[model samples]
Target: MRNAHRVEQVRAAEAELMARLPEGALMQRAAAGLAATCARLLTRRRGRVYGSRVVVLAGSGDNGGDALYAGAVLARRGARVSAVLLAPERAHAGGLAALRAAHGQVVLDQEVGLADFSRADLVLDGIVGIGGRGGLRAEAVPYARAARRGTVVAVDVPSGVDADTGEVAGVALRADVTVCFGTYKPGLLIDPGAGYAGAVQLVGIGLDLPPADVSALQHPAVAELLPEPGAESDKYRRGVVGVAAGSATYPGAALLAVAGALHGGAGAVRYVGTAAEEVVRRFPETLVTEGGPAGAGRVQAWVVGPGGGEGARQALAEALASDVPVLVDADGLTELGRLGPGALAGRTAPTLLTPHTGEAARLLAGADGGAPPPADELAAARLATARRLAAAYRATVLLKGSTTVVADPGGAARVNPTGTSWLATAGSGDVLAGLAGSLLAAGLPVLDAASVAAYLHGLAGRHAASTPGAPVTALQVAAALPAVWRQVRASATADE
Candidate 1:
């Protein structure tokens, strides 16, 4: 799992490292790393480090300080560096002195022409740090936009992103690369912000960051979480998935969902809904049940609500009330809104909710009068959201998107790293839900199951996208699963 430290947690770690080292030691290390990165960029481009125009977007904090010191390094190497001070008075005194020593000039107000920025080969964004609040101030947004016209490198974080939440409150800076100090902040890994962050580079500031309480799935974790059957294991021992999906109007959703579960390593899949006949006609191996969850009895886990229509409402309620772990998706999430988390709270089994942004917003809106915490940004952290929901009503929450987060009811959170835009196709989510259910039924813990399933699903989608604009159907995604599974296992074995 990829460890992510919160700003405060990072601050505490920084404090520890600072206390142990000489004064300004940590910042100097940070600055040195930043300088080295700029040096590499210059070298890679086969451009002159000397006489190359370098623009620093300086702000009021340590982030700007890093840029200033890095500017000093470049100045010594022969670059004509200019610091565009966004808040001249609040600039770091030490950084300013260092720049002056290295022949770096400060550009105040709009005195530095925007044309200068256009001429620069590289722009360094030091407008904000982890301590920053909200988006880029109105004065800075225009410059950030202009910098995007050139190669932009961000120090620590790209200015204007919510470091913890990845949300863009207003205007945000885009970067060619963001050189982070110490451990990664959520902004560098989570989407929207991560997308803007470009290629991430961790600068070794040498601080011993606290082990992340919440982590995203790394490649190794994905391998460990996937299922491997024993020779003695029967189809029943491997597990079976009961799918209650699709209506007569949308039998394809049933087919897709079942297709996902086929590679789930389940001995069999029991299909129950108006689409049962269709699933039976297609797969033949899937047992078609005339009734839903109750009648589809004795399965390891249940995947409910893909194309359920009005009939979805009833299937969702039944799945929630079941003892086995359940994966709720698509229409199921809508039904969850009506039944509420209350229906699943008292149950002893695990419940997984795979909701995209819109579904997540609705879930939060419904949880209105809950206990207080920091603003929504921190709360949206997987551990905070997952546990809050887990405690509020009991269920594992797998909030899906570019950064797929799986949070257990009480402890940590796992983020899935293996996904791309290709998985955005219609019926894609149905496949994911079915796969997750199969994992849950196979007896992996909810957070691990959901996250690993997501990783595998993403790999399948990637393999299935044969060409640009080529349709990646759910069945093809399913057919691609063995390749995904083999790839992970091969990687794992190679690692050892």
Candidate 2:
């Protein structure tokens, strides 16, 4: 797992580490890592660092000092380096002296800074640190709009991005690479701010920290969480997932959901809905039944909704009434929103709610009895949105979007790192819902089920859209799951 700490946690850890070290030891370690990464990037871009043009955008804090000191190292290596101070008077005095000693050019004029920023082979952005909020200062706004010819490396978190929430309220500078000190920031892992951060590289300054509230699962961590059958396992023992979805108006939803469940590590799938005939015709292996979830024989878990149409409300209620875990999605989420959080109050089993921002708005409004907030606003602050929904509903929530975030009511969260834009196609979410529900049937906790399903679903989407990169259908994404599953397991075993 890749852990991400909030801004306050990072600050506390940094301060404690600094106190134990020499006056400048910690900064030197950070600068050395920054300079090394810059050197590698420069070597890859051209042949060498010699004669390359490097520009440093320095602010008034330690962030700027880190950049200036790194620039001094590059200058000694024969790069033609220049420093543009956004706050000249408050700039780090030691960093300024070091850069000047290395014969680096210092420009205080904004026009000259803009000119250098546009054409430099590499630009180091230090205009604002993790503590800075809102957006870039007025003096630094031009750099955000300037045409650039090379890679821009942000000192830590990207300027103007919320290190704690990943919220970008105003204009923020985009970076090709961000070298964060200590641990990863939540802003660098979640979207909006994540989109601005091209590629992230972590440089540890060796700080002891507590458990992280946010994390992203890597391949190994996911591999360990996957459910595998034992020697004595039978079909029933492995677990059966019950899917209550679809209607006369949208029978395809049932087919797509079952397709995902079949390969989701569950031994069997028992489907009950109005689309039973269509599901049997497509996936004959599915155990189909008539009517609603209440009549569906035995199932370890229930996946309700997904093109349920008029039958969604009944299906959602029946699934919640069951003693097993339930996952609600699509039309089912709409029903849950109408009924509010109280709908799940009587249930003892675990519940997972998967909603895109639009549905999320409805769920929030349902909880508070107000007009739905704009989808864009909720999406901009995905971390908080997911946590809020989880708390309000008292269930695990998987907020699906540019970055899939899974949060429990207790505030522990995980962000999925795998996925492509192609996963945004129709019925993709239905497939995800079924896969996650199947995992729940197989006995993974709500959080693990949602996170693992997201990981595999994302990989499957990437595979379906690979090579020629043509548009793929929802079934193609489902078909790609088995291969990706094998790939994930194989890669994990090889690493061992």
Candidate 3:
């Protein structure tokens, strides 16, 4: 699992580490890692760091100090290093002295900064740290835009992004490489900020931090969570997933959802919707019935609402009434809003809600009885939005978009890392919902079920898209699941 800590948590860990270490030791560690990464990048780009032109955009904080000190290291190794001080009066005294001792040039003029930035082989962005808000300050704004040729390396985080929420308030510096110290910040993993951060590299500064509330599952972690049958397992022993989706008008939704469920380790997929004929025709293996979830025979878990059209409300209610785990998506999410949290009240089994940004807005609006925040805003602040919705509904939520974030009501969250934008195709959410619901039936915990579903769905999407990114239909993604699943298990076993 790749963990991300909030700024406050990072600060606390840094303070604790600093208290035990000698003064300047922690900074040196950070600087050393930063310089090494820069040196490697420089070598990759220009074949050598020696005689390379490097510019440091230094602000007033520790981030600026980290960049300045790193620049000094590069200067000592024969690189032509220069610092553009955004805040000359508040520059780190120690860092400045070190840079001067190493013969690195320092300048305070914005025009001179822009000139150096345009000509440099590398630009280290230290204009803003993790704690910064809004956009670049007036003085730093021009330089941020001036660097177009060389690689831009952001210190800890790219400036102007909300490190906790991943929201870009205004213009933010985009980095080709982001060197984060101690722990990964949420911003670097989640979207608008994630978009700004090209490649993220974490440097262990040895801060003893607590386990993260937010994390992204890697292949090994996901492999461990995958459901596998035991020696004594039978068809019924594995698990059964009941899908209540599709109407006569949109049977494709049911087909796509069933496709996902079929590959999700569930022993059987029971279909209950108006699209039973279409579903059965495409997937003869499915146990099809034209009825509501309440009368869907026995099922380990229920996936309610994908293109249910008019039947979504009743289907969602009936699924909620069941003792089995339930995953609500698409039209079900819309009906859920009308019923509010009361519909989920007094349920013993776990409930998972999967919503795209637009659906999430409606859910939030209905929960608060107010106008929902714009979908774009919600997308930017995905972490907080997922957490809030989870708490409001007292269920697990998988907020789907460029990044899929799963959040439990108690605050545990997982960000999916393997998705491609190619997943934005029609009926993709239906597939994801079915896969997640099947995992729930297979007895993974709600969070694990959602996280693993997202992980597989993303990988499958990537497989369907292939290299250079071609358009992928939802069925192609579903078809790719088994291969991705096999690859994941194989990789995991090979490691052992």
Best by lDDT: 2
Q: Write the per-residue lDDT of candidate 1 for residues 109-172, one digit (tens) a residue.
A: 5646466677787888998988886789987888766643557899998998777756667788
How accurate locally, in lDDT, is each candidate? Answer: 0.80, 0.94, 0.92
**lDDT over C-alpha atoms for residue 9 of model 2:** 90
Give the per-residue lDDT digits (tens) of candidate 2, residues 294-363.
Answer: 9988999999999999999999998999999999999999999999999999888999999999999999
lDDT of 3 by residue, 305-415 (tens): 999889999999899999999999999999998778888999999999999999999998889888878999898789999999999999999999888899999999999
- Candidate 2 C-alpha error for residue 323, in Å: 1.5
Deviation in Å, model 2, residue 404 alpha carbon: 1.0
Q: 1 or 2: which has the higher TM-score? A: 2
TM-score of 3: 0.99
TM-score of each: 0.91, 0.99, 0.99
How many residue pairs clash in each candidate at the backbone level? 2, 0, 0
A best-first ranking of the candidates according to their TM-score comes to 2, 3, 1
Model 3: colliding residue pairs: none
Q: Each prediction's Cα RMSD? A: 3.3, 0.9, 0.9
